[model samples]
Target: MELPRHYNENRLVLMVQEPTIIFSYWELSRGQWESLGDERFLVLRLYTTGSNRVSTVLKEVSLPPFTNDWYFRNVLPEHTYHAELGYYGPEGEFYPLLRSNKVVTPRTRPVEGMVRFLKVKTVILDTTNKDTAEEQGDSNAFWGGYSSMDLVHRS
Candidate 1:
């Protein structure tokens, strides 16, 4: 499937491999960003173990005044702000999607370590459709639907 026009620009692509979801944050030059409409947006890609479909949860987070080490050492409460792109199986049951503990660490020079943390989750969907399985098999295809998580804290 072709990616949405909005995602066709100079954007980061997250690929869900096994055990870890790898994030490739693009370093768009001025010209590159301008050519792509220059929208300051983040893109996330998720892969699952093909079990059950789940609803995407979006959360906004805040950290107390603490050193970086302190922040990483404790679990913090997160405030959920938005959730969209809910998934349903053939039975039409609602499943819950969660953020995995593996965080993406930014590697770019200027933004290196700028991102405090990232949480990647495998959306489990409950279904038995063979067509869905086929669609997922095409590695070149892009799934339009995505889960969005805006922030990450200790907890």
Candidate 2:
């Protein structure tokens, strides 16, 4: 997928800060891959509720530079939650680009009025198990593991 025009000049980072979950079928360009370092990787933060699960399946095998693509599925009992997506750089931070509240009926497309933007800083990842952290050590693994991303948003 093509990245939004605004993100072209900005740097993008993605992190899975939620507890025990797996992300599959996602690929990043050499540039995007290199943009993320240990300290900077904390810029992209996503969270989930107790016992909730989040999963991503890539539809495309390869992606080009300046591309923003996401395919996600969630399984939760009966609670609404927010999922934040955005880019973090020296300039500042952005988020709430998308949000969803659990309803009685299932949703196929993102619910309207569910998207917004917020300037945020410092994201935390609380995990349920140690194995999740161990798996994250193997970056080469097809399914990437979990990690925390703390964004420091500027005014």
Candidate 3:
């Protein structure tokens, strides 16, 4: 089946490819495409929200002319992100054309143990385990001193 390049509609979409990357695509209507003046250029702004629910711009990427898709990398697991398609006005003011839906990256197994896993034995520990951390509090009950390699071999 053949698909048209674009639907000629102004739209933006953001999708999480995994726990650390995002894929985004956008389309501009004919009128929106012509709206870029001589001094204006296209740009995509990636925003991330923290626990406070406040959004901040993480990265601003300059897009080549007539581009449609972008890939964002190095995003933290379990983080919220969104994107905005816009252009800078002649005076350096931002005028957004479209806003994408918010997305949260899935938490991975390794991130749960990054702090503890990077320790002496490369053991991955779940920091949020309240039950194990409460029993005697010796920090050995959760996985029984299993390093990441041990888990790999056992499984």
Question: In model 2, what lDDT does residue 124 have?
Answer: 30
lDDT of 2 at 23: 31
Error of 3 at 153 (Å): 19
Model 2 bad stretches (over 4 Å): 1-46, 49-69, 91-155
Off by more than 4 A, model 1:
1-23, 38-40, 49-155
User: For residue 30, what is the lDDT in candidate 3?
Assistant: 88
Q: For model 3, what is the alpha-carbon lDDT of residue 121?
A: 23
TM-score for predicted model 3 compared with the true structure: 0.68
Worst 10 residues of 2 by lDDT: 146-155
TM-score of 1: 0.18
Instruction: For candidate 1, write residues 1-155 as lDDT tens digits.
Output: 98542443333233223222232232334464454353323222232221244433332222122211111211112211111111234475533222233233323235334443333333333365435433556453334432233333312
Q: What is the TM-score of each candidate against the true structure?
A: 0.18, 0.21, 0.68
User: How displaced is residue 40 in candidate 1, in Å?
Assistant: 4.2
Q: How accurate is candidate 1 locally (lDDT)?
A: 0.30
Best by lDDT: 3
Q: Write the per-residue lDDT of candidate 2 for residues 1-155, one digit (tens) a residue.
A: 97653433333333222322223222334564466644342222334444435633221122234445443344332333333433356666442222323222134355564344453333333474535433455443344322222222321
Superior by TM-score: candidate 1 or candidate 2: 2
Q: Give one digit per residue, the lDDT tens place, for model 3 in 1-155.
A: 99988788999999999899999999989888777756667899999999998999999999997689999999898899999999887688999999999999998865555232433422334766544434536565344355676777789
* lDDT of every predicted structure (CA atoms): 0.30, 0.36, 0.84
